[model samples]
Target: MFDGIKILNADADIQKLMYSSVLDWNSVVNDGTGEVVGRTAEYNNLTLTIKEETSLVKVTGSLHKYANAGIHNADDFTPERLAGVLDSIQKLGIGINSALNNLEFGVNIETPFPPAKLLERLICHQRREFTRHVSKGFEYYQCEHERQFVVKIYDKGRQFGLRSNLLRFEIKVLTMQVLHKKGIGIYTLSDLLNQKLYPKIGNLLIQCFNEILFDEPTIDTTNLSKKDSDLLINGRNHKFWRPFSESNFETKQKYDTARKMRYRQEKRFRQMIDSSPTAERLHKLAAELIATKWEILSNPIVPLLHYTLNVEMGQSIIPTAKECPITGIDISDQKGSSRYLSERTLKSDPELLKSLPVTIGQQRRRKHHHPEEYYVAHNIRNAASNPRNSIKRRIERAVKNTPLFQADEVIRLTDEQKKILQSVPSNVPRNKKPR
Candidate 1:
């Protein structure tokens, strides 16, 4: 459910605990200056880096790997397991309330088709083109990096060398403002312990994928009428349905007719895709992903024994209860936690293991055409006369200076304000300017 995370500006005491007998920290020196500027340490699959100048400690690693013996995150990371991992971190003196600088949530699922083929067909996301990237053996398609978030659809099976056709769809939240906009008020690690919020998070992930525009190869034009063929062909090129305007066209009637034609075409095209066989299968996978997420997130989380996933057998293996090295207490005797998944249930119902999937839909329209000769002048004109309204202007302002966990403080007021404020009278000779 959750993967890579970064904790920034850890407390002094927590920094000491990270460098104590628990893990050894080695000094990092500047090659040119020969001066120690920081210290770093690797604990399991997690890494902690400390800067000498600011005395700030940053921790970066996969929460899934940390919970699963510092190994691959190819299995379902249940909410119950997440709670146990959070408990262990709290015991280690790393405050669970620590603010997260970066957070990623995704699911690994066995796709109906090859992930590579799917990536090839995935052309655009909200009008922004996808940039292909390969890290390790995993291949992924990602949209242009935005300040709020980055969406990734990658081959998880290839990354881990699994024999299954596993695809991972993830959203990397670069800022918490994105979460705030989605009504997810998570600010720190402690907020993640709320099992009730799992459905909201799952829905958010689904929504991100839903906004993607797919160029489905399954669309066949052979049996289609002229009208259907026009929509199918025009919709695929994203630019054929351009916005109509007085400057673009000579007459108002002409632009109006063009706008109406494209509008009708777009509506019909959406309906066509909604009823198509390929679309149905894609939506079905999305439905399954959300259902599984809801089931796991709603489960009671507890400090249960650590478990590992057996990919071959598709089972989660939990060994016999033993004392934890950090806390010096029996794992079964932990207090103040909910008993969500017991040892008996896990062994008997390994079939409960599953993952998530999603679909996409969104479009972008260009406002004007540029003169090829005047590149510099065209860029200046575009920047000054861009089609940004009040809401977009506010968002741009917020993105410039907002903190990761503080964007909530600077949003617009709700609609339930005073009626006077909602409908202010225009200034006149008799109307005095209000201070």
Candidate 2:
């Protein structure tokens, strides 16, 4: 009947307790005491005995029959039902040994296991009860036995749910130890528990238990509520929610700015597509542009820039670089450079240059003939009379005002006028009347 059960780190106290209970049964069968000892044997300084009467039977052994039964039936023990118990006992033994060893070595026991194991054990018992119906012959059991089993399992599961809630409370107590060992930040627990960090460990835990609980709606609701409670206790509420308070005006402002910037970027892209009859082609071009920008943003360039800025500043304070460190050029060196500022620089720059929109104007003219040359030349002539603002502003104006120019439509200038406009430079000074 005990087949497939496993006992791990079985404590002597638990063994003694089981033995004592069996001995009581033996006493009942034997009319109390050694009056009716049926069989007894000793081997390796340990005793084993079985006593039987008309209506009762009992077995006892000095070798710890309970441990033997458990070990022999290890496979019968489901992890959901027994893992916490086994882990607790093992941790207990380790704790005692650690304390003893420390006393011997003259060092204090630095870390102690919390009540998490007790809570875990409770959870295991709950899971065992929930799965009890699946056990062999459970259907054949008497109504009383069935009711008792169901009640026991339900009660255990409820108790476990309540007790496990304390884990969230223990976060503060465990935080220092976790940070010390893992080198994580003080707020790591909050960060992990926050909904912002969902799809990580928090999601995994929720999914694991949901599967275990048969995906019942009631259990799912309870789990979510419990998780929220845990989050609040672990300071995750503060991590995610506190920034919305009136006192955090600066943070709120920055968040609003970012939201607006994203909205504007999307709106502008939509407008560009709306202005074009070739929607599909424009969409493909937009997708390519966005993908390229995402790839560039994901590169290690930002971190490298931060490092360079730090080195140049010679301090750990804010790292700022106004130029592309690798290319040794100003921030506006590239064709559409104004949009490439680091997030940090955007946050601090008084003019908020990065918040301005990107502008893709017509390409500049090359010396020789090319299909794009006419368009470039037309835009250059259009912009020539206007004073240049920042490179980004100039591009923006050009993009807003210039229509797509056709190559065949270039205006023919008089030969003399063309010669005067394109006059060549000379190394030799021209002779002139004395002035």
Best by TM-score: 1
Task: Assess every candidate by TM-score.
Answer: 0.61, 0.14
Lowest lDDT sum, 10 consecutive residues, model 2, at: 101-110
Worst window of 10 by summed lDDT in candidate 1: 353-362
Residue 296 local lDDT, model 1: 37
- CA RMSD (A), model 1: 22.9
* Candidate closest to the true structure, highest lDDT: 1
* Model 2 lDDT tens row, 1-435: 001111122222323333442323223235556465454333222233333333112212211222333222111111112222323323322111111100000000101123223222221111232222323322111111122211111122122233221111001111133232433222311111111111122222222222221111111223335543343233211122212234554687777876565345334433433344333232222222222222222222333232211111243322224433211124553334332333334334535432231221245446755433234323323322111122224345445555575422333322222322343212123463211
Candidate 1 structure lDDT? 0.59
Off by over 4 Å in 1: 12-15, 237-266, 277-280, 297-435
- Distance from true location, Cα of 62 in model 2, Å: 15
lDDT of 1 by residue, 11-116 (tens): 3355546547767888899999999999888765778788989878787888889888788888878766776776666555566667888889887766555667
